[model samples]
Target: MTVALLETAWLVPLYPLLAALLSLAWSPGLISRTGPRPCGYLNLLMVSAAFVHSVVALTALHTNARAGAEALYRPITFGWTWLDTAGLRIGFDGLITEPALVAMTVITGLHVLVQLYSIAYLEMDWGWPRFFGSLSFFEAGLCALVLTDSLFFSYVILELLTFGTYLIVGTWYNQPLVVKGARDAFLTKRIGDLILLAGVIALLPLTGTWNFHGLQGWAADQINNHNTLPPAITLILLALIAGPMGKCAQIPLHLWLDEAMESPLPSTVLRNSVVVVGGAWVLLRLEPLIELSPLVQTVLVIVGGTSALVGSLIALAQIDVKRALSFLVSSWLGLLFVAVGLGGIDVADHLMLVYPLAMALMLMAVGAIVLTNITQDLTQLGGLWSKRPLMGLAFLTGAAGLMALPPFGGFAALRELLELTAASSSPAVLGGVVLITNALISAGLIRVFGLIWAGRPSVFTTRSPEVLWLMALPTFVLMGLMLHLPQLLVINGVFSLSPLPGWGPQALPLLLSTLVGGGLSAVFYLRPHPLAHLPAALGGLQDWLAHDMQTERFYHRTVVWLVVSLARLSAWSDDRLIDGFSGASGSAAMAGARRLSLTTSGRSQLYALTLVLGVVLMAIWLLATPAAAPELVRPFS
Candidate 1:
């Protein structure tokens, strides 16, 4: 393709955004008059077009790369300057072509499949237009996020997606939990976006640019020239990390995601599969800036490692299937954070590449299960394996990928993390921790699966309907993709187990950890004992785990409560203090004028007497003072 044609890659995301706008702007009356199917078909067409454009862009990028065309890798800039201010500038720059092309292709491609799947999943629902419209909007936002090079623009897009999440999660507005969940998700993510904005704003003054490429170059130049950035840089990094932490649902920011499971399965698919990865992607994009400060990197490592450990432990105790998987998502992302903190970009990149596939598979399987059983709680259902063999198989395959088993994408990524941890300072301790977390994750996955598919039919299961092929088809596709992802990675140079020391040593501990974790999970959950008390043994910790450590409550009481109180105080002051003072001052002035009027009753004579008295006093003073008569003497001369 010619350069101009190649640049059409930007249109990939733009098309969906436009379609979303059109769908949203189209009145509900018009949609109702026409029908929801037309709108759905229109959305499908737009997404399909975007997907085709992404594929073409990827093909062009690959061909150009093979031809040694480095210029093809550069970001495709477009549009007017996004923002400009005192000594700082930002623009609408993004990688319309290159690696973003690949990311867009994967994200939109999966969205298309998910949307197709949702047709059947939500067939009985009347909110088709709203659901599909929001899905398109999410695709557009995510695509723009991947393409954008400016941190400021990235933050804006992140906020936009946060809004989209709110809408999608609250699609079922009649459900109180759905409303609460959507609000919590939006509020939590907004907190992170605000922090990230602070970082982006601080960065603009420090570097005078917001473009990722420019910032990376500037940061590298500073390091090369032995320049020291101010302490504000670390604060900026921390602020930026807040966005990722919320997006990736790490630690304290994780509660929103668990609650968000009350949303439809399609939204869950998008959130878990690709939307969360937006945070990790931004983190990777700013890796150079982050590596500038050791303090920042240390914080990342600690938060990531701690989140991974704690999230996985919680995952082991979760009773809600989606909640458990949500914890797994957080835990896995924490591992990615560790990779990034340790300066393992390649490993981080590999993990990013693989995580979405694993997540997509898991979500697809979960979507299928939830569709059939009408519940996401594992404790409410069982014996689905015989009824829906395809879904069960898909779930098992996805679980394998999540467990980091051989020939799965998670395996390659986890291997890299283990190797890196083993070669780090606290190899023994870190390795042990990572190993234990993996084991817990394995147990968590198997526990969910067993509770969903293995035992005798429960009341919920007995009432459950058979899953349609629309859902099963997507699940199977994802399962097949998971099975073949290792080979794909190998071809892409992500699965090369090279014995480089800096890449870390793959010794017995690493191998043994995987084996032990997998084996224990298989024994405990897959092949359960008749007298097993494992499920009953967990109890409240399970509740806490299901609730995602009460992060929402903490944020509500601390951050949300504080903000609301301060706002109320401000409103009170505005209404009662400042306005009241102004009103009181006006009233006092009126009262004083009224008193003066009372004192000046029959005012004409009083005014004349006072004027005569004042004039007489002036005349007496002038006659007594020599200087007072000077003007009269001068006039006579």
Candidate 2:
């Protein structure tokens, strides 16, 4: 009960948020006086401070836990009640816990690296202040998201982050595609958030609390009492899943991430690396509630497995480097979903821990490439190894980690996943799906590397110089970090080889999958082929893959069209029904005013006469109302 304000972890998220607000306030005049460079440096400073604070909090948590501190610490109070009712009360408060601290560490650390990378990646852009400001805002939201305990508050923060995505992606509003991309991202996430809100409302009556711990307790009690049913729990789970689907960019809600590549590379790095994982985080956070329903778990595994397979296929056909990475983001998230569905929270948690690092490395490399060549399309670039060997090396290392090659973090996570599936009922089907998906992801990454570093030098790439060290430094650091993450996992008990039946499986399949995928990529995109044309059998599948399984088109035709039509109908109703009623009332009032005006002209005597007449009429009416009064009295009686 120290109640030490400074020691509390809430400050970690608040610092960057305050900085973002300050930067946004000063943004208009910032460039006019001090310019974008200073703003970029300011952003770096803000994120650095948050990162330091996060580290401090993490250290404190570890120390306390090692000392066997009580499970429930003193709640950090912010203000008065947020809402109060006859039998329930919700408060605006915050608290720090182990999970929150861990998530904060990951988010803040990634932000630091990404912001540092952005310094060189966006150096020449005029909208630097806007870019850094939005990024800081996003960091603030994500940090707050991790710290909050209330599901209601978590959803609020998620919505705020969705808005941040809109602004960050459309920072260059003059560009038409960027504008559309931003709009699409916002609208799609909004739909999912609205659905989640419905779920939240439904749960309030049942649990009588919005706090994560409280809700979990209630759910557990309900399950123990044998009162929970599939239908009711499935409804709640579906509602909760909506937000993650939108945030994670899973199928039916994933096209935004692909289109979002139009944004700056720094933003893309953030989205792919950490922001998109927010959904998976939510799923993990609510694992107990979801586990109460078998139907929910089954649905998660099916969606996740299908998304992984489809996402990998699409990644293979993507021409844009960022789009390919975006697809991979979805695929990895889907894998996390599968882990959660199979009741493998530990495995999912480990995957979440390692994914951001790998994604950050890959995005940093892509950022460097795009900056140097001024393009993201793999079809338009080549021969960068000689110009920027460090970048090529970083890309390869990142690719290795992404494809789950041995001695990397992804390999450890995938092994855990394989083991988890092996113990499950549908082991063969699930295992095969994961294997093939991993293979396709490997091929996708290798294909990108070949297009960039192996083929003939493009005109744009030939003239570009090697990237500056500011960018390369962060990229290489992340690459090195990824290389050592598997060791960290072992040390941290994220995974261990033990007497557990599925543990310590042979590594041959992992190695062979990586080699075969890599070799296939080299053969197709790197090695020279006499005919340069793929077989006709794959033509249809290739086209389907290239189009992202027609997800975007489906959304456009169905969701987008429906939304547009609803908007139009709403507009028409507002104008015709609501406004028209108001308009008619106004017209009637005006007509009455005009009619009265006609009688008011130059008429003091007439006014007196009318007033006298009105008084006489009132008296007559009062006298005549006795009969009506008697009738009213009879009715009441």
Q: After superposition, how far is residue 384 of candidate 2 from its true place, in Å?
A: 2.0
Residue range 1-637, candidate 1, lDDT tens digits: 5444566667777788877877864436564667676777788899998888777667666666542264364455665585569754567787664567768988988988888888888888777778888999999999988888878888888888888888899999998888988887887777778888888888877887888888899989989999978878899889988999999988777777877787888878888989999999999999999889988888888889888898887777677777788888888899899989888898898788877877777778777777777787877878777776777777778777766566666666777788888777788776776777777777777777787887778787876666787777777777788787776767766566444212234544554666776666656655456433446666655577556577667777988799999999999999999999999999999999998888776779988998999999999999998773545445554
TM-score, cand. 2 vs. native: 0.87
TM-score against truth, every candidate: 0.90, 0.87
Candidate 1 Cα misplacement greater than 4 A, ranges: 1-5, 25-27, 64-68, 71-79, 84-88, 497-508, 527-540, 564-580, 596-637
Q: Best-fitting candidate, measured by lDDT?
A: 2
Candidate 2 residue-wise lDDT, 1-637, digit = tens: 2224225678887778877877764578744767667777887898898887777766665555532153236433343477789867876456666677678888888888888888877777878778888888989988888777788888988989988899898988998988999998888787789989999888887777788878789878887898846466589888998889889988777877887887888888888888998878777888989888888898889989988888988888778888888898889888998999999999898788878887888778878888878888887898777887778888888887777676677777787888889898999988887788888888888888888888778887887677888888888888888777767767767666453212367355755777887788788877545333446876777678888877777877987799899999999999999999999999999999999888767869988998999999999989987663444345554
What Cα-based lDDT does every candidate model obtain?
0.79, 0.80
RMSD of 2: 4.9
Model 1: pairs clashing at backbone N, Cα or C within 3 Å: none
